[model samples]
Target: MDAIFIQILNGLDKGGAYALIALGLTLVFGTLGVVNFAHGALFMLGAFCAVTTQKLLTISKHVQDTSITFFDAYKDQPYLEIWWGDFGRTIIDWSVPLSILLTIPAMLLIGLSMERGLIRHFYKRSHAEQILMTFGLAIVLQEIIRSIFGANPIPTPAPDIIAGSAPIGALFGLDEALVYPWWRLIYLLFSIITVSGVFAFLQLTTFGMVVRAGMHDRETVGLLGINVERRFTVVFGLAAVVTGLAGAMYAPILSPDYHMGMDFLVLSFIVVVVGGMGSLRGAVAAGFLLGLLQSFASMNEVKTIIPGIDQIIIYLVAVVIILVRPRGLMGRKGVMED
Candidate 1:
C-alpha cells in the first residue's frame, strides 16, 4: 500500500509536466491547425529564462579579501550582494522563483514573433511542410541555445525554505519513509492550478468564447466581423506561454539542458496522439494515465516479471490505444482520422 501510494505521487509528478506540455501542444493545434514541432524549443527557452535570471542575479566581481584567503587569493561576491548586501543575496537565493517574471514576457514575445514572422506564412501549407519547417526551427533554436549556454545541464535549485523532502506518508497516516521532494509536490499543485485556470479562462471569458468559436468555425466567426486570424495568433502565443511556464517551473526539478526539450517533445507527442489530437481534455487525461502506467511498470515486481517493461511501457500503451481507438481516446469523428 505504501509503495503504491508513493508510485502514485511519482506518477502524478511526472504527469504534471507531460500534461502541461501536451495541453499547450493541443492549444496550438486546435487554434492554428499548425503542427508546431518547435513547441519543445519554446519549453527549452523558458528553462533558459530561469537560468538567465539566475545568472543575471549572480553577476559577480573578484575582490581581494584579506579576511579569507584559503582557497583563492580573491573572493567572488555577486554584484547584487556586493551592492545591496543581504537583500541582493536573498534575490540571488530565490532566483528560480523570481525568474517566473522574466519567463512570461519573454515567452509571449517569442511566441508572437514566431507566429507573425514565420508560422503565419505556412498555415495554409501541408502538414509535412509545417513539420519540416518547424522541426528545422526547433533545431535552430536549440543550436542557438547551445551556442550561448553550452550543451551542459544547468541546475536551478528551489528556494532554501522548501529545498528538502516532504514526509508525504505522514499526511496519509503511513510510514514516514515514503517521502517525496517538496518541489515535486509544489509542481503538482502548480500544474493543477495552471490547468484549471486555462480551462476557466476559456469557458468563462468572452474572449475565450470568441476564440472557441473561431477554432470551430473560423469562416463563420470571421463573417460575424471578428478577427479570427489575430485571435488565433494570440492563442498560439498563449500556448507558447503555457509551455514556457511549464519549463520554467520544471527547471528546479530537472536541470535545464540544451537537449531537454527534445527529450520531452517525443513523449509529449506520444501523449497527444494517445489522448486524441486537438482534444485538451484528452491530452490531460492520457498524460496522467501513461504516467501512472509507467510508474507501475517501473516497480521491482513488475520489472522482475517483464524485464525492462518500464522503458517500453509508455510506447506500448500508446500503440495499444492507437490500434484500438484509431483517432485517439477522445478524438472527434474526423479530426486526425481525416
Candidate 2:
C-alpha cells in the first residue's frame, strides 16, 4: 500500500513535467497551425537559464593561498561571498528559484526571435518542412548549448531547506515510511498553478479569447481588423515561455544537459498526440494518464508479468488510444484531421 501510494505520487510528479511541455506544444499547434519540433530546445534553454543565473551569482576571484598548498595556488572565492558574506551565500543557495525571473525574459526574447526570424517564413509550409526545419533548428540549438556549456549534465539542486524528503503518508494516518521529495511536491504544485493559470487566461481574459478565436477562425478574426498574426506571434512566444519555465523549475529534478531537449521531445510529442493534437485539456489529461501507467508499469510485480513494460508502456498506450479514437480523447473534428 505504501509503495502504491508513493508510485502514484511519483507518476503525478513525472506527469507534471510531461503536461507542462505538452501544454506548450498544444499552444503553438493550436494557435499557429505549425508543428514545432524545436519546442524541446526551448525547454533546454530554460534549464540553461537557471544554470546561467547560478554562474552569474557565483562569479569568483582567485586568491593565492600558500598555507593551503605547498606551492602557491589560488583558491576561488565567489564575488558574492566576498561582498555580502552570508547574504551572498543565501542568494547563491537560492539560485534555482531566483533564476525563474531571469528565465522569463530570456525565453520570451528567444521565442519571439525564433518566430519572427525563422518560423514566420515557414508558416504556410507543409508539416514535413516544418518538422525538418524545426528539427534541424533543435539540433543547432543543442550544438550551441553544447559548445557553451559542454555535453555533460550540470547539477542544479533544490534549496537546502526543502532538499530533504517529506513524510506525506502521515497526512493519511499511514506510517511515516512513505516519504517523498519536497522539491517534487513543490514542482507538482507549480505545475497545477501554471496549468490553471493558462486555462484561466484562455477562458476568462479578452486577450486569451482573441487568441482562441484566432485558433478557430483565424481568417474571420483577421477580417474583423484584429492583428491575428501579431497575436499568434505572442502566443508562440508564450508557448516557448511555458516550456522554458517548466525546464527551469525542473533543473533540480533532472540535471540540465545539451541532449535533455531531445530526450523529452519524443515523449512530449507522444503526449500531445495521445491528448489530441490541438486540445490543451487533452494534453494535460493524457500526460498524467500515461505518467501513471508508466509509474505502475515499473513495479517489480508488473514488470515480472510483462517484461520491460516500464520502458514501453507509454508507447503501447499511445497505439491503443490512437486505434480506438483516431481523433484522440478530445480532439476537434477538423483541427488536425486533414
The segments of candidate 1 whose C-alpha lies over 4 angstroms from its true place after superposition are: 69-72
Q: Which residue ranges in model 2 land beyond 4 Å of their true spot? A: 64-73
User: For residues 159-220, could you state the per-residue lDDT of candidate 1 as single tens digits?
Assistant: 88899999888887899788889999999998998888889988999999998887677789
TM-score against native, each model: 0.97, 0.96
TM value for model 1: 0.97
lDDT of 1 at 153: 97
TM-score of 2: 0.96
lDDT of 2 by residue, 69-165 (tens): 6677788889998999999999999999999999999999999999999999998999999999999999999999999999899999889989999
Clashes of each: 0, 0
lDDT of 2 at 159: 90
- Alpha carbon deviation, residue 140, candidate 2 (Å): 0.5
